[model samples]
Target: MSFAISSNDVRIEERDGHTYLIASSRDEDGNYNHTELNLDECLGNNEGSFNWSGEGFTGSAENIHLSIEGPEQLPILRAHLRDSEGNTHDRDVNLSERIVNDNGCLVFQ
Candidate 1:
């Protein structure tokens, strides 16, 4: 129902060579509802900025930057979003655990 605002609130999962970016939170029923994005389709390179807006997701982000660094090229995401009420939020997430160094290429695992 809301945006995932921290590294701890986000999770990356790899399945059948596809990488998924997931965020979850509890609903009014006390059940966890998940929001997922397919990174393989949206993420074109190691580092770039993107914007996403739609229904069933949270706030619309005007700027969502993704970058990879260090020896292994681990991922880091910074997002700035505006909610329906015009409230703004900024989020920074370190997504290193799901990224693996395969030989020299950065692969999602």
Candidate 2:
């Protein structure tokens, strides 16, 4: 599913054995700057829930892509996916920043 963040809202998506959290803001140029988080690692730990945070931007969705990050902050990009309740069956995803997209679609970073 899709979610809208009123320039300051945080968004979370859980789907296909994974969870995605994104914090985004708009820029004067009308481009979205997004900070994304993957819950697979935390969820794999069997933790009930986890929190995520990131910076903000000031724009809209310029492009969509899947973003993957490792412990050292390495990023991997891919397509997007649809999020569903089954995705969160094992863990809870939380967001501390604003999100613009919450769908489970694979988005290439």
Candidate 3:
């Protein structure tokens, strides 16, 4: 009974007119688990960092945490996820900067 979260699983989506930062992962039973966040208040115009720590619904996971931050001004990718085994894996760069552009802005073409 061991599960964990990854920083690479972070994604920005707009649902119900709300921009949420959804961190997705699988639990010990291979069940999909997601943690949502309101990026509107979490991050501002300038750039900020955040940490989220929690366990899966099955409780068979480590208290994994994902840190979100951006606007490095130089493509400073700093997203890393610590697995249940305590291994820190690096995520994509500039993944957090897209939130400002994708928050409430959509295109129809």
Candidate 4:
């Protein structure tokens, strides 16, 4: 399993006062996999944290933390994942540029 995630693989989306965090990855063979976390549902708020596990680039995230940073107040998520192969990954997803629009409304404040 060579799955990996970076800032570029993360996205934040807002819809009807709800927020979501999404991460995606593509393998060398062009297989795409994604995980979507509803912030309000999983973490209880817009800027919150949660844990997840999946397949292919499958892994588990623990001690997940989310926060806002910089003058623009962008969302940031920090977590460590252990792949199925037992490889560990530490990632800080700066969600500033990865914010996506949902139904023509996407804002983080």
Best by lDDT: 1
Which tens-of-lDDT digit does each residue in 37-97 have in candidate 1? 5655543321222322212122244355565546544457665655556665676545554
Instruction: Count clashing pairs, candidate 1.
Output: 0
Estimate the TM-score of every prediction.
Answer: 0.34, 0.29, 0.29, 0.39
Ranking by TM-score: 4, 1, 3, 2
Worst 10 residues of 3 by lDDT: 53-62
Candidate 4: where is the Cα deviation over 4 Å?
1-59, 101-109
The numbered model that scores best in TM-score is 4
Q: Ten-residue segment with the worst summed lDDT in candidate 4?
A: 50-59
Q: Per-residue lDDT of 20-51 in model 2, one digit per residue for the tens?
A: 55556454566556655664433222112222
Which of candidates 2 and 3 is the stronger one according to lDDT? Answer: 3
Tens digit per residue, CA lDDT, model 3, 63-103: 22334443332222233444456554543333333332222
Candidate 1 stretches with Cα past 4 Å from truth are 1-59, 97-109
Candidate 4 per-residue lDDT, tens place, 1-109, comes to 0112322255555555555566564434555556565654433211222332211111254446656666555567666656456555676655444334322233232
lDDT score, candidate 4, position 10: 52
Q: Which sections of candidate 2 miss by over 4 Å? A: 1-7, 25-32, 45-109
Model 4, backbone clash pairs (residues 3+ apart or across chains), number: 0
